[model samples]
Target: MSAPTTHRSAEEIGRTLAGPRPLPPLGATREVPLPEVVTETLPSGLRVLAVHRPGVPMVEMRLRVPFAAPGSVADPAFTARAELLSSAMLTGTATHDRVGIDDELAGVGAELGVAVDPERLLVHGSGLAEGLPTVLDVLADVLTGATYPEPELLRERERLVERISVARAQPRTVAREALQRKRFGDHPIALEMPSGEAVAAVDPGEVRALHAEGVMPRGSTLVLVGELDPAEAIAAVGKVLGGWTGAAQARELGPPPVTAAGPLELVHRPGSVQSQLRLTAPALRRDEEGYAAYQLANLVFGGYFSSRWMENVREDKGYTYGAHSGTEFVPGGAVLGVETDVASDVTAAALLETRYELGRMVAVPPTADEIEAARRYAVGSLLISLDSQGGLASTLAALDAAGLSIDWLRERPVRLEAVTPEQVAEAALEYFAPERFTGVVVGDAEVIGPRLRALGGVE
Candidate 1:
């Protein structure tokens, strides 16, 4: 068939597309009931939280033990000891060698791994629901009886030192380390890991001692998510871990102040060809009244690909491949930041545009359409994240760590929907103002430094 000739004008088509069309009414929000969660504080002060999700045949378990060393984070020995301890915890225990532990995990089609940051040592285990008992038993064994065998510890220590070396050589890692030190100074919450030499100095005895002193269940939280009875899970946990005893309370690094204030902090990487830019500031807790508005504001700024910041930096100017901004929670507070990498030639221009976007968001409130789009994206992401077993498990663990409950999560859609354009603008004014941000730019000092210093924000 022959096509008919088009007679519609471009303006007419544009107007028709821009006009609102009738749409179906939205259905009432389907509220998923909170899972049956059983929480108990055992005699040893371990807080065990179990939830029965009842869909998938598998289970997810997470144990967060407060492993903060008593010494300052600035102490190389302290950082080294904590890192080696986490790496060695699951290498062996009293009765199980490394291979034996792997065999037990494989028997149940499960895997357990341990990781640590400044605040806690996290043991993550997952398996089929039928293997819950085995999972718990193995976890208990590692928690209470890890031996940190010398050969395994030494091998892991060497591997970690090598990894640290590799990480330090990367530009992003260098920028991150500089940002951490600039933001927190010598505070324990600074993101610096131990040096390679420090890791080499960590002996097996130190790992064992650190585990004995810091890897206690008292004040720790254990979250289990799976297709099982919550009561039964709790009982299983108690039977396995209840007798474990410790007197130390969880160490809280409430919130680190944004120490890299005043001008932008420049970490000079001589003869570099690119720059990593970080703009950061302290933010509010997730449960704060302003959180929803703040969330929307961040989305409108750079939290997603289609945001104004991304459009400005990546699409319009071609300054960078990607740009993003997001928030991370601490015990009682949050840190909000923007990150991007740019070629050395465009580094100053990109930084200027970033600040301009920050100022624009504060000065000119987002349009109604912008507000609705941002709000929907934020709320939809949250709901979608909890739709899977692993997602729900992680959500529960994270919120619990923040002292929030599942009910708070359930209520977030309404809260996000309630946020008005004005609220977002207000949040932008408060949290995203250019002056609220302290930054670090890692690049060729000769190329970007004078331009940055001339911009007046670089010290």
Candidate 2:
């Protein structure tokens, strides 16, 4: 084996990797305009949005059921019920066995999936236009009449238990879970993982009961069907789901209370060489005033690869591979976050630089050129995000679920274009507060602990 292929020296490797390449000039801008699409809403409260591109023979349907998380009832078993109910939907239904359902979908070249988030359960599927009826039929069966097989439910619960255990082994996942727990406190948003004991303790009856109550069609649903004949699509949905009736009123849960612990939170991970850092506070929802301005500010800071955070933290200082910031806009306001991994030795320096960059943005407004470039980038990116049928369906579904008007698709670009630099600066100053922010670092407790302590007290 040729002496097991001896390893090369670090200096030799470095020399071999040294090469230069051309790069795009700084502050260069590219502008692309997006096509405005039309939207319509049916009498049954189903929203339809379409982009008339004549190529694909497929339609994508996404049905969103709100209240996938716990309501204001404060039931301790709400999380468990939501999880078990969502999982059981995939196992089987009353009319079709698991194998039969899989074979049926494969025969028609259709796909169906269910996803559970903090706010909703989404049932999405796609098929060729000719196969849409069959796909819808299968989806309706699964969503309306899922039978929680006792044996399969037990098996899935075991699998999820093992998966949660595996997630515990990852430092980043553990740290984020911890941060959410501390930040959200008793709110349902903080419940990231369902316990193994809880999953096992949940019975089939509980899952069925939660599904019946929470998955009703009255105030609990928003349907989006894209790239199909609107009349036919709506008729098909109404014909199938009209009989599906329940009277559970949609509970309006208030926004999560604002809580801030400061700029530095250190989660100790033994024997770690680098620190994982997350800095965030509260920010505006998607429908709030200055939402567009907040987005533009984040884009100028860390939303894009060429944004300030990446330029300073990665390209200029070489403290990390990459760094970016983003906001999670739900029913409540939340601040943007800049997340990065840096060497344990330079963790404090990196944190200081991050704070300085944020402060600078607040002090000096972005130039007109920077503001326009950011706007162009944001508009172009949003266009690309809604390019596909499934993408269109998802975007509209999200908007409708959030109670926005159907004209949001046409109004988005105008809103983005009208954002001013002053607005961006003001929004950043109001939202991004380094003093009130929480910074959680997961790394070698022995090394990072001292560094964080020197900078400020780490919580």
Candidate 3:
């Protein structure tokens, strides 16, 4: 050894002759430009939107038919019937049996399916670009002439009942049902999952009747995006789906009752080890001017993993594994919801800290670092969500349902970039105030009930 090695202090190693090196400035963000789109309404009253996104030789398709049930839809069997109809619709059509239908789609590397909610029934599919005609023809066959055969219906009905039973026993599902009731009272939106008994009672006649009544063309939308010519695509859709005719405009669910501020309701779940905490308040819709700022404020609150709520409740205190807050767009408005799950032993402690974080959102608001991070996330997420052809197709269908066009989506990046810290602070105070939130807590009554009652503002 030449000499004994001596360790240098970190400060000595860090200081350079030219002084501390400053961090390199951040690079400018690259923005992806949107492609041109062709939009038109066919003679059958179905709106068609097509875009030429020439990347992969594949195409994505989305069809949205307004299936909002009228007041008369409260018929005891209506919800059950609607659920079964969505599952049974693709089992067979007049032109082809179930196997034959699948074979046609398989030959073209295509898959199609339907799902329903309180608002609409969405038919989604994808296929090779050259097989557009085959896909459209299959869709048309189902749309106008699906026959809910008894054998298929019987099998699907049993599956539905089993799924419903398993889902209801879940903690998250229990919380969702309780939250829906608290927020909407007796509104149809609160009736998300039909009882197992109701589903078991549905027969083929009810499903066919529901399809004829709800699956109309006038207010429906179809979107196709991939390697194709937009103009040709629109013409093809019109020619293929020309026979899908309906006279009346599809009904839409009216705006839900405004969420009111009140005390928390304790929905009892017996002998639970974990408690689900959910909270909700009013928020601005996407079309509203203040929505951008509100969106940023929401992120700083609990919308992301690094958010203040997460930092306090998870990193700092170790009370829960994860927490979240998000905006849900309803018919005419939007709402903010915060959710988390914590062990029953710490249920009261978690609630106190949650309320404290909510109060701090209004009192202290977010710092410059928090605001900048949330704004950047908002911009980056919007761009990423619309980056692919399938993503773009789905976005178009959802926007069409809300009476918005793709232009609204293209401008979102700029809108998020322009939101100022002052605006976010104002929105935090206006909307995130603790008094404005009301929701349900799902946990064991014997374990958490007394602590929750002692906490007050909870019953």
Candidate 4:
């Protein structure tokens, strides 16, 4: 074979680099307008917000309850109570048994789902616009008249207990859960996984009590109805939920206390083939002034697949299959995390590289190319999030629950586009501190324990 022809001319290389490149702007200059929505309050103190869209034949309903699992109440009993009450709400009501509820829902072709977050329980459902009244009736019945049958409650409790037991067996789950518990330790937020014993210990009476106390329709509740006439939707909701009365005491579990700076902690699991590394620290809340800047900085670092973390850790070094970082913005300060699983042999190297990348973020501004790509991806992903009825409803409902105004939603694109590279760098410096992070690694203790102790000075 002929030697591969090497056109080793510096002039050719320089010409290639000097070629014209039409680059887009670094940040978005224009704002996308948000939909106009109406808001009102019901006699029962339920806050209702609605957005009217003519073409869709369906309405999305979401009920936001303020009773999120508190960080201070880490006992497995409370954790199990929160989850079981949310699930059992739909299993049966005073008038409709489980079978009846299922048949009625099938008849209307409606779907109901529940989600429990760090700070709230969201009961949401969707149905045809004309069938909203039926759906609402069912929702009201479930919320107001749910009777936690002993047999059904026992079944769900046992099922959840089994699920928790299975989750404990996975290394990734173990590392994440252990890190959360250590970070928040004894706080409600740290109770990410309920113990099987705790799940099994919950009785029907406790489920009913938690439900009655937590799911009150006072200032603590938000009703978001989408793709319907605002007046009509509000009227329907008020009529159905008006009679729902409860003097439930709202639990005043405040936000998680700021974590004290401490040396990294490692959870050693022997016989593990891969090392699961989790590096975490405190970060900005969703509504913080620096949120926009921090978001851009995270994108440049590891929020996206094409981010710096992935490029350096996976593409360049091949130390691990993948690595990424993100921040969860709850009622309290956000939790920032960078996580990955690497072969046991390269666990230490992976940790060093991750720390290097995190430190580099604060030391230097991202290149214009990197900044533009990150902004584009962030804005483009947001636009995609608005493409469906459910997506639109979800976005609106979440924003409403978080107390974000429509104007803020409308201006999100502009804010994202206007973020400068220097702003991202500053955000990184302000929010991320390598020494303050808690590093939890699950692997063979013999292999990683000594290395971690040497690096982190942990005895």
Candidate 5:
């Protein structure tokens, strides 16, 4: 056998032939030009936004309809019907059976999906550029005339029931449910997922009725992005979907009761192997002034893997696999949520470190280095998010839902660059203080309860 080759150590390989290689300067960032968007509201009341993104020969579409239950407290019956409606929406229309619908979509190299949450119903689709008409036509056919056949309803109801049962048992799902209830007592937005019993009660007639009442044209938006002319795409969409008419406006979801900062709720999940540490507090909205500062402060704290909280809680202390914090927008305002999962044994220690980081964020505030790093990351990530037609389409749809236009996105980088260090510090103090948050600690109470109670912030 040949003698084993002498191996170079990683450090030796990394060395230049010199003592140490000098780091090259970063290339200057070039300003990216945004595509001009075409927008119009059809006579039938559907708002259409189209933009050209000729990077690839594909088209992406997104439709957002405010589909919340029209009340302060969510009606479980309506929530269940909405779930069943979304599942059955693409099953068939007046002229096509389920397979026929599939065959037609496949013929055009297109596919579509529908989903519902407490806030809105979304229909997202993608296809070859040449097949945009077929996609829109099929979408219109379903939106205007979905007949929830009994057979499909029976099967879908069973599947949904099974899915809900499985989801309710998942640790993440249980934590989220507990957190929602802890944050907003009985608000409709807290009902993120329907219960199994609620889903089982859905019937075809009720689903069809919800389709008639909730899936209207007004207060809804459709966004199209692809390798095509913007004006031509907008006109085509309006022409094709002109028949989807209704006088009733889709009900909009109002903002929930504000999250109050108080003691951390301890929810017992006996014999659990891991504990979930979830914390949340109110933050600024995207449209608000100094929002960019809030974004940078969030990044410096725990919005990215290289954040302070991640360094302290996971890297230094070995408390978790990962830790994350980010801003989540609601109907009107926004909130910052920080969360991590750790072994039950380390639950108390993790919570302690988490609170320490939060207190540091408030008292010491982010340094200039941290602010610059976060700003660079914020600008880079924003550009990356819009680099694809699908991403652009999705972003536009979400912005429209929030009553913001593409101009906000186009100016985002400049806004981020202009955020002052003082603003970031102010945001940190206002949003990331330990006392500003309330949340839940979910795990085996018997294993974690004593230590958490000793920690004092957690109840």
Candidate 6:
């Protein structure tokens, strides 16, 4: 083959490859049947949401308990105690020691994990459908009969402290911590994680007490999605968790207060080679009507790989390897956040470009093509995320907490499709405007700080 006398430049080749093809006529979305959801509140006040999803011979369980500490000023050690408790809860129970518990779970091809945030404690796991009873039994044993053995508590505490130390040294973590502090002020939630000293001070007695006080059934929700019948599952849950009762209701802290945005803070990380950027603002919850528009707007901006933010910052400017912005749902509300990491030399330029893109997205409404691509991605990803048994169960638990049901979830694609470019533009104007975001950049202050302040917005 003869070489071409003149080769097409990379830009020409790229444009040719990226040129849009005619979109086929959209087809009617195949409706996935909503699983039958049966909800039962036990006499002891434990709420159970059981969904019968056929096909898989596995059961996924998700439990959410309102585990926030009481008072505006949480005990300095509360987070530490809770972390230790979550780690040690399954180490040993009255009926089974740590080894025995693991062996029993292995026999059922199951595993369980406990996690805690400021607002809730989550217990999640999966097992064979035939092993549902065994899983529940083991879970109950851990919840009610956990011994909080001293040695296990100490081991977990040390491990967590080590992890926290490593995490605290990370640029992303430092950025997040600085942003939380600036946004929340002295609020207890601003603490994020406990100090290493606090973790070391936590003991078995404190963990046991935290479990006894916060792990009650009144405000906890158990969600099960599997091949089993919903009614049967609910009944089984009632039998096992019926006697686990408590009078104390889980405290519901209303939504966190929203701080006015646009104050950029700098977190000094000495000798850092790269800077972590995080821009965040208060956002709407999934249940809100405007949330659909907001979500589409986010996807079109930086929520996806092919978004405008990534196209500009990574593909065009080569300022960062990756960039993303998305909404994170917490107990009462949501926060929209954008994140990226860039070399120290380009930190200011990246921030400037980020702000420019944020402003431009609103100034220029998305094209029909952009809107449709984002819509398809949003709908397709939602379906894919719920394709598995575990994903379905976790999604159910979260939606239930938000007072939504499976039927609502099944209709998400339709809602996503209905989001218009006008709606996205409006959402961008309201939520994604650069002035509405306050954030932090963590880097070597000597390298990036003067330049950041010179760019305006940074204080």
Question: Relative to the true structure, how large is the alpha-carbon lDDT of every model?
Answer: 0.83, 0.71, 0.88, 0.76, 0.89, 0.84
Model 6 ranges with Cα > 4 A deviation: 1-23, 28-32
Better of 1 and 3 by TM-score: 3
Residues 1-459, model 1: lDDT tens digits: 999887977656556565844557554343545675788887788888888888889999888877665654456688888888878888998999999999999899899988888778888878999998898888888888999899999899999999999988899998988877877777777755889998998878878888877877777899988888888888888898765777877665545654444678888888889999998888878888898898988999999988999999999999999999999776557788799999999998999999999999988878888888887677677778888778888788888887888888778877877778888888989998888888799998988988888888897
- By the lDDT metric, which is better: model 3 or model 6? 3
Regions more than 4 Å wrong, model 3? 1-24, 27-32, 72-76
RMSD of 2: 9.0
Which ten contiguous residues of candidate 2 have the minimum total lDDT? 27-36
Mind giving the per-residue lDDT tens digits that candidate 5 earns over 387-442? 88888999899888888988888888778878889999998888888888999999
- Candidate 6 TM-score over all chains jointly: 0.93
- For lDDT, candidate 1 versus 3, the one ahead is 3
Which portions of model 5 miss their true places by more than 4 Å? 1-21, 27-32
For candidate 6, lDDT tens digit of each residue in 87-124?
78889988898999999898999999998877788999
Which candidate number has the best TM-score? 5
Better of 2 and 6 by TM-score: 6
Worst 10 residues of 5 by lDDT: 25-34
Pairs of colliding residues, candidate 3: none
Candidate 4 global CA lDDT score:
0.76
TM-score, one value per model: 0.93, 0.86, 0.94, 0.89, 0.95, 0.93
> At residue 434, what lDDT does model 5 achieve?
85
lDDT of 5 at 20: 62
| Ranking 2 against 6 by lDDT, winner | 6
Q: After superposition, how far is residue 109 of candidate 4 from its true place, in Å?
A: 1.5
Clashes of each: 0, 8, 0, 7, 0, 0
The better candidate by lDDT, 1 or 2, is 1
Query: Superposing every Cα of model 5 onto the true structure, what RMSD results?
Result: 4.4
